[model samples]
Target chain A: MKISLFATCLSDAFFPRVSEAMARLLARYGIRLTFPEGQTCCGQPAFNSGYWVEAKEAARRLIDAFRDSDYVIAPSGSCISMIHHHYPALFRDDPAELRMARELAEKSYEFSQFLVGVLGVSDVGARFPHRVTYHPSCHGSRLLGVKDEPLTLLSHVRDLDFVPLPFAEDCCGFGGTFAVKMADISAAMVTEKADHVRETEAEVLVGLDMGCLMNIGGRMRHRGQAVRVMHLAELLYEGVRMADERA
Target chain B: MSGHNPTSTLAERVRIALNNDFLRNAVRFTTERLRTNKQAAAEQIGNWEEWRERGRQIRLHTIAHLDYYLAQFAENLRRAGGYVHFASTAEEAVAITLQIMAAKQAKSVVKSKSMVSEEVHINQALEEQGIETVETDLGEYIIQLAGETPSHIIIPAIHKNKAQVAELFSEVAGEPLPADTAVLAAFARSKLRGKFLEADIGMTGCNFAIAESGSIVLFSNEGNARMVSTVPRTQITMMGMERILPSWEDLEVMATLLPRSATGQKLTVYMSAINGPRRTADGDGPDELHVIIIDNGRSRQLGDPEFQEVLNCIRCGACLNACPVYRHIGGHAYGWVYSGPIGAVLTPVLNEEKEKWAEVANASTLCGACYEACPVKIPLHDMLVYIRRRNVEEGRTKRTERLGMKTYKVAVSSHRFYQLALKLGRIGQKPLVRDGQIPTRLGPLKGWNNVRTAPALAERSFRESWQALERELQQEMAEMSPQVKARLEELAGKRGDRHEQ
Candidate 1:
């Protein structure tokens, strides 16, 4: 089975460590991940901004990139959500691309989803002693219904003190272009999210999507706070490394 | 109403709202309390999803056959001694209302909480003709006293605090009334009772119009709707054309959903259905009832695939409480009669100049929280995108924003260009990058940097490192275990996705 990586553009350009961590962690189970070079983006930025014509142009390339893979996984739930939730409608005009879009949607999965649902591996023999809180990005949890898979994975991690984020489901306001277009409103939203994360008083803030994590983490940094922000994949991988070093 | 575009642009309005700490905290506290109560109420009545779907189906069926149900409702209402008028425009609705007021020679009209009346600017119209119009509902009365429109569908004065309410009431009381809830309620109750007795007409907004029974239904916590409908000699009901339910049975679903979603009550304190004008034998009720069904751009949405489901909204304000944008800015920032997720969609769709209301749609993050919270399952998040698409198709978006998206299209069209763009981004950030992060408050980063640090591109992108990672992984590669492989194959055979909303 050819398992491919759809390194969402944000993960590809800004947080490459997320994909690297995902690749290393999945490799522990003998799953060799394939990187399809043709993929660039899921076209959510254009799609959300009402430029479906351009969004389709961006999406067609991505759908074709993973056409041959048996399964495609991404570290960010938002990107996978864009593929599975919007791609079919994005390509609705062309029947051929629509079929490929549907095919791509079926094979694609967010990282923890691919881990727990497909591999049936909730516990990856990882240990993290730090207190952490998770921010469920709105797109990932609401659009994709990826509510439990991440929680299940976190629950299985040894010695990981996880405090649930207050108002965990509220948007961090990193809505693709929304952060720029409606910046003030977006700032207010992220400010509230940062306040909640602070309320948790956790050492690290973990979330599924880089978009949300970046927004909240950026706000935390601006406020001169030292709360480490990480992708769930990166957190789990670091936990594995911590356990390995102890061993 | 307060949403009458007082501040001009949405950005300026949002700026003002964000700076108002008291308004933000008040909205946040109330919405949080309401949201928690709604969740508890919905959970206490198990299978909330089933109820939502049922309410959605009934609304869908009724709307799909709107013309048929509306005709039946009109005829039945006429037979039950109620006059029925259909208005296609806001002007027409107001004209019909004014004509009725003229016929009744109404000097004063007492009103319940009627969003439709607000939409028509009826109070201003009535006042222009030298007739008195008073809001009888507590929140509506408070906002009316402040010379503002309702900021919320259910909680009209959601943005106002008790002190503000006291201020509004003290002016009417001609004394220094304390900013106490009990004192304020007593003041309003006594003050409104006099108007209700002296008014020549009663006015109301219908929650649901039952087609089979020719009845108008109202759900209110204060019982003010009952007084509004029963007090005056003549009664006027203003209903949106889409507020029809096929029968009383369908209203049962709505009755269960509306109050719970609005304020987390299983049932409103007062639920009334007026079959028609008071029967000849009836001792107390409006002697003459007039039903004015107002279209006001609603008929345009009847067949529109993208926006039709928006009508499924029961005006519960659940979406408002769920919306993060609304939580920060409150209702007035929407700059129209409706606010929150529903307002974002409705303002653009229900107005003639779509371009003018375009920015209202951008206020949301397209977070889909509203859809999740909607009791009738209206897909507001998707509808917002469609509204934005309409704006884009008509050349309503900013030229620079359009150009930016077009440039983005070119960059992401192929992986090579996308890589080249990232390479450019990395090099472009060298001067701005401070210890691996771009904290500069310059250029496009101004708004973003004002609130948070912008991340600079990584030293090496994932794809740039993929080749080396693959070589390292090749040496460690092993065969997948049998059980996992079988699970993968089994998963590959299925087609339906749980993500399909």
Candidate 2:
């Protein structure tokens, strides 16, 4: 079965390290994850903003790019959510594309889901020593039902102090264009979320989705916080590196 | 902005709500408590998903055969000696209500908390005809005293504090009242009790109307819904046409989900299931009953696949309490009878003023909190997107957003333009990046940068480095265990079977 990496636009453009960490970490299991460069985005920005035609334009490319891949892995659950939930609806008028979209949706998995769920590798034989709190991205947990996979992965990290972030289930107000359109309300929400993050007092703040991490981490930066904001993949990869050095 | 002047733009409405510290704190504190309690309650209920699914199935089944059920309901209600009036619009509903009041010679009307009544502007119509109408539900009473609409579906006065309630009560009492909860409750209880005893007619909103028994169910913590349906000589119920359950068994499922989702109660303090007006053998029931089944744009959703499930909402306010946006801005920012996520979707669609109410749909982060919290799982996040799609399709979206989306289409239509855009973004942000962050509050970044810094684009896009990364990983490839391989194939096989179904 061909497995392709769907490095979401955010993961692709701004946080390539997350994709690198994800690829590097998965390789420990001998799984060769392929990258289909023809993929640009899952079209969530336009889709959520109400431009279905534009969203469909982007979706069509994605459908074409990964047509032959047996399984698809995306770092961001929000993009995976779009592929699983909206792609079929977006391409309902075209039978061939719709069938492909359905198959793609069935096979696509968020990174942690691909790890803990598919591979059944929670520990990944990694160790990290730091105070870490997780902000479960809203789309990842709520929309995609990716509740336990991340937690299951986190529980296996050696010496990883997992303090829960307060109101961690709450959105970071980064609804793609929502941050731009409803600025003040989004600001207030992110401020509250940042305050909760500060309350955790953890050395590292980790999450699953880059879009949300950007929103919350951006607020932390705006507040002059030095708390490290890393994706779970990066943290796991670093932990594996630490484990290797200690060994 | 549930009560804000309709002319105010969503930004202006959001500005007002955000700026008011008192309103913000009150809304946030109350919703936090309600949300926490609801979480605990859902956990205690064990098998919350099963209950949610049951409620969803009941509603879906009823709505699918709504025409049959509605006709059966009218016939059953008529057989029970209850007068059923069908009103296709708000105006017609209001006219029917006025006609009932006129026929009964109703000089005064006492009402329980009724969202449908608020939707129809019932008090205004009654007051214009020189009929005295008083709200008996504590929250509704406070809102009535202030001459404002309810900001919340469950907690109508969620935005008000004790001091505000005391101040509102002080004017009614003709004396200064202390800002104490018990004292205010005593004042309202005494004041509303008199109205209930003296009023000629009682008005209520139906929570669920049972078709088989020809009964209307009322769920209330305040016990005022009981009084409104009882004490008065005449009773008038304003039922949203969509509020119907096929039987008492379905009601049992609804009863399980509504209160737990609303306020964390297993059951409301008073769960009154009234089967028509009264029998001669009944001692303290209304002499006459008028059930006004108001369509008022509800039937518009009946045939619509996108919006039909919105009718499945049990008016529990779970979405309001769970919504991060509603928690910050309060209900008035929505500027409608309904507020929060439900308000965001319905205010535009129900009003059929998609162009006018377009911005209401923009207020959410599409987080799916509302859907997760909904008793029947309405998929409000998806609906919000659909509402936005409708707006965009009708050209109701902003010019800038339209242009931005158009540009996005061109950018992501293929990888070449996408690569160039990434390169341009990196180059463009070089001047803006301070310590690897764009802290500038200028141009399009103004809204975002006002509260958060922005990130500089990666030096190398993922695709740019994909070839090298693939080459690097090839050598390090470990042998996969056959068991792991089999498990993955089995999972994939199961997924394939699901798609065929």
> Per-residue lDDT for A98 in model 1?
87
lDDT of 2 by residue, B1-501 (tens): 136578888899899999999999999999999989898999998999999999999999999998888898989988988999999989999999999998888899999888998889899999999999999999999988898889999999999999999999999999999999999999999988889999999999999999988888999988999999999989999999889999999999998899999999888899998888889899788988889999888999988989999988889999999999999999998987899999998898889666778889999999999999999999999999999898888888778888888889999998999999998888888887777788999999999988889998888888899889889889888787898889878987897788778
Docking class of 1: high
| DockQ, candidate no. 1 | 0.84
TM-score of each: 0.98, 0.97
Give the Cα lDDT of each candidate.
Answer: 0.91, 0.90
Report per-candidate DockQ: 0.84, 0.87
Quote the B-chain TM-score, candidate 1.
0.97
For candidate 2, give the DockQ. 0.87
**Where does model 2 exceed 4 Å of error?**
B488-501
The sequence of per-residue lDDT tens digits that candidate 2 reaches over residues A98-189 is 88888888889999999988898878877989999999998889878999998888899999999999888888898999999899999999
Kindly state the fnat score of candidate 2.
0.94
lDDT score of residue A1 within candidate 1: 72
Chain A accuracy of model 1 expressed as TM-score: 0.98
- Which residue runs of candidate 1 sit more than 4 Å off their true CA positions? B1-3, B494-501
